[model samples]
Every structure is written in structure tokens, then in C-alpha cells.
Target: MMASARFLIPLGIFIAVAAFLFKGLSLDPKEVPSPLIGKAAPEFSLPLLNDFEAPFANGDMTGEVWLLNVFASWCGPCLDEHPIIVNFARSTAVPVVGFNYKDRPRAAKQWLNRHGDPYTQVVVDLNGRIGLDYGVYGVPETFLIDQQGIIRYKKIGPLTQMDVSQDIIPLIEELSQ
Candidate 1:
């Protein structure tokens, strides 16, 4: 009887492990939940990409819903995401602040010129310190911050039109009210 109990316990544990693994595999990597959601965005002040003498601070955006799009000139995904961001920027009233992460100023500018600058303001995170503060997993990640400065949503990868339509627009409308 004791031997049968031991076998049953091991089988139960194996089943539990398998179930957890299967669930994890079914989860989307792009849907990673951010720890910053509902929390105030990390404070940062960085030089603008086009101008080094000027600074842009987190406190500068206190009265409106905004997007912080982390991108780099060297990042391939940023190239793919740029068009979507540009269209979204043009269609929306919400400000889009490009967070240029760990990139050369000249390269960023050239890239934007070749593509199109959709950002209302482009801040340079030359050292990636500000990106670290924002918990950037990779280039092309975006954060939606509410008017009060709380981070409402974090998209871990490049923004898709579907994401912009189904998630971003709705949240921005809701937050604006």
C-alpha cells in the first residue's frame, strides 16, 4: 500500500509539470506582462535627437496621453515598425515621443529622414540608461502613458495595426476621458 501511494504521488507531480509546460508553450511571447503597468513611468531626462543643448524630461508630459516608442537606427524591427508608427502618429492627436535607444544621433536622424519622422519629439538615450529605467526588452517596444503619467500598457514588440486599432486607440480614448 505504501509503495502504491509513492507511485501515485510521483505520477501526480509529473502530470502537474506537464500541464504547466503545455500552458507555458501555448502562451504568446509577445504578450509579456509588464511590471510597470498601472505604475508611474520611470523618470528620465535626455537630449533631443536633433538637438543636444535641449533636454526632454518625463515631467514634461503631465497633461496628456502619450506614447514612448523605443527604437534604434540599427534595429531591423524598428525599420519595419516605422511605417505603422508614422501612420498612427498622423491619425492621432496623442503625442508620440520617440525614445532613441543606444544609437548615434546622426544615424537616427538619417534613418528618420529616409523614412519619416513620426515623433512629436525624439529623445536620445545614447547610453541606454533611460531605456533600462523603462525596462526595455528590446528595440521597437512601446509604452502607453496616461495623462497622470502612469504607464497604462506596454507592447513588447513592434506595434501592429491591429494592436493600434484594437488596443492602443481604445485605451487612449478611455484614458483621455
Candidate 2:
């Protein structure tokens, strides 16, 4: 009985610590309404992917309501959602910026070439440092930044047509004014 009690005590402590760590660590995907809403978007400066040229920074996106899309060449859903992004760019005044998370330069270039780049600017976050700053837990997440550089909305998964029509389009419309 004493041995069992001793084991139980340690096990209980371990479980408590594990729970605390998980809770304190970061966001869980099931939690929908992100806290970034109506807050200034996180600032980051990352190297541009095209031609390995000038840096694209958060400062560059200020004064505009923009979409920041986190994608990876290796992520399948990103490829699936690429065309929708293109259509959005073609039809709307809202600009899209791409965060190429954790992809090789060659793959990033090829992905853009084959799928068509819809972003006004593309930044390659090779080590995911920028993504970490942006509170990204996964690829294919998108944040809507308002004209004053505040993050107004966050979409956690692959953006669907309904998401575009119901959430994104409405947010863009509201911000455009």
C-alpha cells in the first residue's frame, strides 16, 4: 500500500507538471478566436525570396490592410489553396504577402513558378523565426492586418470558399473603409 501511494504521488505530480507545461507553452489549434485581433501585428524583417533580393519587413506592409499567408512548399493544403489566393489577388485590392516557412529556396521558387505567385511580396522564413514571432503554430495559417498595421483576424487552417465569402471578404471590406 505504501509503495502504491508513493508511485501515485509522483505520477500525480508528473501529470500536473505536464498539464501546466502544455497550457503555458503556446496556442492549441482547437481554440478558435485568436488574441491577436485588434492588436498590432508582430514586426519581422525577412529576406525576400525572389532573386534573393532586398529584405521585406513588417514596416513595408504598414498603411494597408493586407493578408499574411504562411505556407510551405511541402505542405499539401498550401498547394490546394494556392489558386484561391490567386483569384483573391486578381479580384480584390487587398494585397497578400507570403511567408515561405521552412522551405528550400529552390522548392520555394518552383512552387511559385508552377502555382503562380499571388503575393505582392514573398519572404522566406527559412528557420521559422518570423513565424514564431507571428504566433504561428502551423502552416497555411493566415492573418488579416488592418490599415493601421493591427492584426484584425486570423484563419487557422486552409481557407475555404466559405471562409473567403463569410470571414475574409467581410473583414477586407470593413478595413478598406
Which regions of candidate 1 deviate over 4 angstroms? 1-22, 29-31
**Tens-digit per-residue lDDT, 49-143, candidate 1:** 88899999989999999999999999999999889999999999889999999998999999999999999999999888889888887788999
The candidate scoring highest on lDDT is 1
> Cα RMSD to native, each candidate?
3.2, 7.7
lDDT of 2 by residue, 1-177 (tens): 998888899889999999989987786656567778788888888888985678888888778889999998999989878888888888998889998999998998898999898999888999998788788876789888887889988887787787788999998887777
TM-scores of the candidates are 0.86, 0.80
lDDT of 1 at 104: 88
**Model 2: residues with Cα > 4 Å off, grouped in runs:** 1-32
